[model samples]
Target: MDRRHCLVTGANRGLGLEFVRQLLARRHHVVATCRHPGKATALNTLAGEYPGRLHVLPLDVAEPRSHAELARELALVTDGEKLDLLVNNAGVLRGSERFGHVQPADLEASFRTNAMGPFLLVQTLASQIADGGTVANISSEVGSIALRQEFRTPSYAIGKAAQNMATSLLAQALESRRIKVVALHPGWVQTDMGGEQAALTAQESVAGLLQVIDHLDEDDSGGFLDWQGQTLPW
Candidate 1:
């Protein structure tokens, strides 16, 4: 595979961090962003190990200003080169919310972090993305309205549903440039968000996701897929 320039959001830990690690192993140039670069010990250490191949920048995905700042910083890091891949991996989930007790604050926060963040971030960085580059939005199965059987995590569910729409819209918006945008469900991985008993490990899930990404074509844009490359219903 050719060396690609890639950027990952919320890359301090879990699946995001794993993506950075694997991409670096593949000898790709990676720009990893988190809310606090100073506190991201793992990513910083990885930067040391990979030298110029890895860059750790600060980005709070929920804030559009932060997105703009990241865009500026990214330009300097890549020296205005277009990015081959962009992974929108930052997200938020509020657990243990009863149907009636779901607070407006939680719902709004989830929307800002899960749905709106990735959508707007892509918009902010669109010019920096290569014409035929790929954008992978880290989505969840719980966001699938067609697959919903019961009431659970309404805030997260709603936010992810909206994000699905955002993905579809973005695909259409970038169609002329031949950029492929898709939503990906990472399965129930064992991470800080996905508890220890989750079905998959972060490494296992990321490996599958990367394979899926590697095989994506223009026809796959706007599609929702699981880490295994299985098509998911919107």
Candidate 2:
């Protein structure tokens, strides 16, 4: 395979960090972003290990200004080259929310980070993405309305559901360029967010997700899928 340029958001830890590691292992050039690059010790360490192959930058996904700044910085990093993949991995889940006690702040934060941020980020960076590139939005199975069995995590659920719509719309918006956009569930990952008892480790989930991403065809754009490449109802 040709060496590809890729970018990953919230890449300081967990699945995002694993994505960066795996992409670098595959010999792809990567730009990894987080809210505070200076505070991202692991990513900074990876930058040393990978040398020029990895670049860690700052990005707060909920903020549009940060997106613009990232765009500017990305241009310099890629040196006019286009990116082959963009992973929208920054997300928030207010695990404390109950039905009546769901805070407005939680909802707003979740919506901005989970739904609006990814959509607007893609729009901002559309020109930077190569023709036939891929956009992978990290989503959750709890976002599935059809699969809902309880009222747990309303804020997260709602945000991801909206993100699902955003992914669909982006697929349409970028169809002419053949940019494949899809929402992917990383499964019950054993990350800080997923907790220690989750079904899969970050390495396992990211490995499977990468395989799924690598196999995506034109027909797979705008679809919802799990880490193992299984289709999930939207």
Candidate 3:
């Protein structure tokens, strides 16, 4: 495969960090973003190993100003070259409180981080993405209204559902440019957010997701898919 320029958000840990590692292994130029780059010792260590191949930047996905600042920094790094892939992996899962106990603040925070942040990040960086590039929004099965059988993580669920819609809309809007946009369910990966009892390992999930991403086309745009490349209901 040809080396590509890629950017990943929330790349300090878990699936996001795994994505960076795998992409670097594949010889892709990666710009890894996390809210606290100074505290991201692991990511910094990876940067030392990759040298010129990896660039770490600070970004808070929930903040518009942060997005703008990142765009400026990226422009300086890539010059006029367009990015080949964008992984909107930053997200928040908070307040598992059942119906009556669900606070508006929790819902608002989740929406800002998981839904609106990705949307705005993409919108801000659309020009930087190559004509035939891809945008993979890391989503979850818990967001699937069609597959909802339990009543947990309400805020996270609602926010991710909104993120799925954002992916659909972005795909349509970027159709002319052939920028494939898809929402991906990484499975029950064992990460900080996924907990120790989760089904899949971060490495296992990311490896599969990268394979799915590697083969995406115009037909796959606007779809919800799992790491295994299985089509999921919206």
Candidate 4:
């Protein structure tokens, strides 16, 4: 199980934490990052429980400076450079404002966290990853044009759209190195973001996502897929 180390952003709680938990269960070392790790008692407990297997790093994906620090930390962790899977999971929503009520500032915040953040993370961490590494951008089906509707989160929708495009662009660019890139939509799950009305539980959604990751291959790279393995429309 020493294939490679995993770094998951937004790993303080919700699906991100669940992803870390599941990966650890599979005997994979996980570097879970959050903006405020000081108060993340659950993550601290996991780190304690797993010893060297679970590492909790303080990171804010929305901040570019943190990317440099994360790089430095990875260098120390791997001697020079080595991390297998990099999951771009950190994201934000501005109080769930409706479409008509979507503030420009709110849209800016959404795009920054959902789209630009992931893009920057990939750009900064590309060197830290070994060849043939995998990057998963936790995207959403709401970004699907073919599946479109007047949603409440225009900014979120647009951001995921950009993220999907980034996924495709990076996939082709990194194709020669065999670095797989994918936009994964974890199905409607109960979380602070997903709200209580969402269908799937966080456990179930993350479990499905992990299953999809476990089955990833070179051919599957650049694909926009749901947690259930269904291909999504652009």
Candidate 5:
């Protein structure tokens, strides 16, 4: 296969960082983006260790203008070459302060990051991914209305639901180009967002996700798939 090039947003830490590390281990070219590259010492250090295998870029998902700027910069550098995969992993989950006391501003911010950010990121990079590439939206099981078992994350739930919608809508738009688009629920992972009681570790979650990704095809486009490869109901 040709050398794989992927762009992973929010790759400073957590699952995003893991994804970059794992992909780099596979000898793929990875563009790891974060809001503050200055503070991302770990990523920058890894970039140095891997040399040409890694490229760290500054990207703030909440900032719309940043996306276009990144596009122009990458285009200038690569001469419009297409990226093989884009992992829309930048997101925020503001735990609603208390049970019914959710802050409206926080909710909006959550939507901006989780929903609007990924949507805009994909839109901006649509031309950068070749016709037959893939896109992964890092969503959560809490967004699953069909599987809701009394989870109380109002802001995160709403944003992820919208994010899943984007997954389908993007699939529809890219279907003609044979690009596979889908949302991958990383599971209740033991990350900063997943908290202490979470059952699965980030490694386990991302492992399952890559497996599901390994099996995806155009027919699987628009589907909501759990990390375990199970189909999820919208």
Candidate 6:
């Protein structure tokens, strides 16, 4: 694969951080974003090791103003260069509070961060994304209404489901530009949110996901898929 310029959100830790590591290892230029640059010790350390290849930016995904700010900053940094990949990997998982006990604030927070953030980011940066570039929105099987067997993680589920819809809508909207947008399930990886008992490690999950992303095309846009490139029932 040719070297590409990539941007990943929530890149200070867990799956997001792993994505940065692997992308940099593949020799791709990467812009890694987190809400707080000062506290991103690991990410900043990686920046030192990778030198000019890695750039870290502060981004608060839930804030619309932050989205606008990031777009402007990136436009200047890239200086007309287009982004080959945009990974909407930043997300939050409020615990599976029972329906009656679910807090409206938690639900709103989840939706803002997990759903609206990614959707707005795409909208703000669409022009900077290369024609035919790929947008991978990290989603989960829990978001699939067809697969729902229990009521758990309502806030997280709702947000991810909305994220899935955003991916579909963006795929259709960006079709003229040949930009492929798709939702992906990274599996139950052992991240802060996934917990230690999770079946997969961050490295394992991201490795499979990168493979899936590598092969995505216009035909795959608007589809929901797992890390192994398997089609998921929406």
The alpha-carbon RMSD values of the candidates against the true structure, listed in the order shown, are: 0.6, 0.6, 0.9, 1.5, 1.4, 0.8
lDDT of 6: 0.94
Error of 4 at 118 (Å): 0.8
Question: Residue by residue across 72-147, what tens digits does model 6's lDDT show?
Answer: 8887666668999999999999985997899999999999999999999999999999999999999999999889
Per-residue alpha-carbon lDDT of model 3 for 163-225, expressed as tens digits? Answer: 999999999999999999999999999999999999999999999999999999899999999
lDDT of 3 at 9: 97
Q: Ten residues in a row with the worst lDDT in model 6?
A: 72-81
For candidate 4, write residues 1-234 as lDDT tens digits: 455689999999898998898889888878999999999899999999999778888788888999889888877765664778999998886656675677888778878888888888888988887688899999999888888866657788888888898899888888998999999999988999999999999999989998898789999999999998889999
TM-score of 6: 0.98
Which of the two candidates, 4 or 6, achieves a greater lDDT against the reference? 6
How much lDDT does each candidate structure score?
Answer: 0.96, 0.96, 0.95, 0.87, 0.88, 0.94
Instruction: Residues 44-158, candidate 1: write the lDDT tens digits.
Output: 9999999889999999999999999999999999988999999999989899999879999999999999999999999999999999999999999999999999999999999
In candidate 1, stretches whose alpha carbon ends up further than 4 angstroms from where it belongs are none
State TM-scores per candidate: 0.99, 0.99, 0.98, 0.95, 0.95, 0.98
Clashes of 2: 0
* Per-model tally of clashing residue pairs: 0, 0, 0, 0, 0, 0
- Residue pairs whose backbone atoms clash in candidate 2: none
* TM-score of candidate 5 against the unseen true structure: 0.95
RMSD of 6: 0.8
Q: Is candidate 2 or candidate 6 better by lDDT?
A: 2
Any runs in candidate 6 off by more than 4 Å, and if so which? none
Error of 3 at 68 (Å): 0.6
Model 2 TM? 0.99
